[model samples]
Target: MVDVTELEQRCADAWPALVDEPLGGWRLRAAGGFTGRANSALTLGDPGLPVPQALDRVKLFAAAHGIAPCAHVVVGAPVEAAVADARWRVDVDHPGGAESLVMTGTLRGFATPKDRAAAVAGTPSPGWWELAAQANPTTAQRRVLGSGSRVGFGEVEREGVVVGAVRGAVVGEVLHVARLAVRPEARRGGVARSLMGALATWGLEHGARVCALQVAEHNSPAVTLYRALGCAEHHRYRYWVPGA
Candidate 1:
């Protein structure tokens, strides 16, 4: 088993490299946080251990940490055995998948202004910024914006007045999809997709070739939409809340 302290340091050190892979962002960062014992005896990235062993290593590490595995993914291995432990929620798909379904797909083009306006008018939910602001009106939104990690690209309107927006980031060769917001009355008219396309286009122009984001696996409708948009699975993760 790895040392808990070392695990913390390793996770931090390894984070920037990991998140650089498109779908990495604030929500993904939050999902990546560590809060237990350390048994990160395995390595990730190039030349890393094979998938089966890696899963075993992660599971062991989770047990050592006293938390169930948060996100467990397996390829080239059986799914049932990997998910046998009670702590994690697991997902399995084809090995080295290309034809497999996407968990977070890359959007490949830019959105037109007309498309952006229409999307803002039709988006269905509040973004992380709005939700954060609602949770604590004074600090979160400002803190995130202040980090210079976020960029806004569209306008949102409510009651015939602009009130919602979309945000994203361009990091190296990948563009991270950050937030999409729309007033409650406007929920299903391709707003989110338009916002995603805008970011993807921005990334390509800025020297990026990939755009990535994540969503709940159970959000079937969203998974369908992303797949239809040409996104393929990059990777997936899960959250292991401490208790009920």
Candidate 2:
């Protein structure tokens, strides 16, 4: 039998590191905010461990704790592989009931300089952010502009009035682009494309070899625009919203 207390401690210590990994998904973020009221489980044993034993341990542990166990699997090495391979799950009793949504992925590298530059120049950026602010002037445009680690370039102007902007910054060799938006009236304009061009130029100058950003999968238009600009899909991430 694995020591439940030790497993929980191990998870707690490793949680932050998981957050830093782009592929760890949003689950790490959820884990950080989770109360002990949330249960977790893991298998710690030699290689070729029995799946039956692992499941039994989780069932027994969850029964005693009055909460479902979050099973963890380690793959490859003995204990490490066991814990890594072990999967965390909840509400196993109800096959169709509410379970956690998994989010995972790696940040994809962008295209080459020549290809990227060409793509950027080929299209125009939208003024979505600019329009949003006008429709709801209470939006926090300036705050998002200033909050990111680095600010790229792009602003939405309506009738010559600048209202929305996109920003980016560089970390190590990675360019993290965030907070992109355009004004309503500026929609369909090449503002975003221009901003992206500026960002690409800035990133290349700063020695950044890749640019990455996160967007909702359902936003087809945005995704299309990005694809046109040489951005490829890296991963599909789902946010397991609280209480859902």
Candidate 3:
């Protein structure tokens, strides 16, 4: 069986929580409002301080960023109980925040789509960012997507414009996929599959053995697409926000 804990750590490393401050063994991350993975405190292990004290520090750190205090807790982790004891409630209503499923698949036999071609760049191009982010992306969001040690920005052009985009970051043996998006009018056109295929091919060329991604449990369409690609759930996590 794959070591879920190690996989979690790999995911964290692959899509780094930028501007992280360590409080004991916990990571207090803040990256504007990009994503919860970069904006919430990560309870990875023993915090080296009392649970309550660590929680207090998290609150202060989030307050300093002018964001609500939040913790990204792996499901069934010991820290989950501690946070619940302190009155933290899971954000059930937050889109994609209630439960995120980490999925993984082998890249050994992956092949690029024959009919679709993608332009791969070491840094995100203007078209890639515009398509992937939908709106104008903030500097922090760009850094989160493109600043990894080994990153690939894949864009599918249609009619002289980017219609699909995805990001792949290699960390050791894992290729973490993120920021996959396609234009609304381009959905159901295999744009997403082409992007994934291109990224997987790029990852294999760069020595990656496995591909991984996080998707919200509520995103049935995305879940079905990834499952069809042979990815299986490796783990799950949820965001725990302090009760108002």
Against the true structure, whose TM-score is highest? 3
Tell me the spans in candidate 3 whose CA falls farther than 4 Å from its real position.
113-115
Candidate 2: tens digits of C-alpha lDDT, residues 70-160: 4432222244333334443333343222222111112232323333312221212444334323333222333333234444444545565
Indicate whether candidate 1 or candidate 3 has the larger TM-score: 3
In candidate 1 the C-alpha lDDT for residue 9 amounts to: 28
Model 2 scores a TM of 0.44
Lowest summed lDDT over 10 consecutive residues: which window, candidate 1? 18-27
lDDT of each: 0.40, 0.41, 0.83
Candidate number with greatest lDDT = 3
lDDT of 2 at 85: 42
Off by over 4 Å in 1: 1-107, 113-115, 118-128, 131-146, 158-164, 240-244
Lowest summed lDDT over 10 consecutive residues: which window, candidate 2?
Answer: 21-30
lDDT of 1 by residue, 1-244 (tens): 2322232223323223212111211112221222111111212232244444545555554565444443322233243233344333322331222122214344453434444543422222344345323433333244333233324344444465544455455554455454455556556866566656665655566665555544455666657766777766654333222222
Q: Model 2 residue 165 lDDT? A: 62
The number of clashing residue pairs in model 1 is 6
How high a TM-score does candidate 3 get? 0.93
Higher lDDT: candidate 2 or 3?
Answer: 3
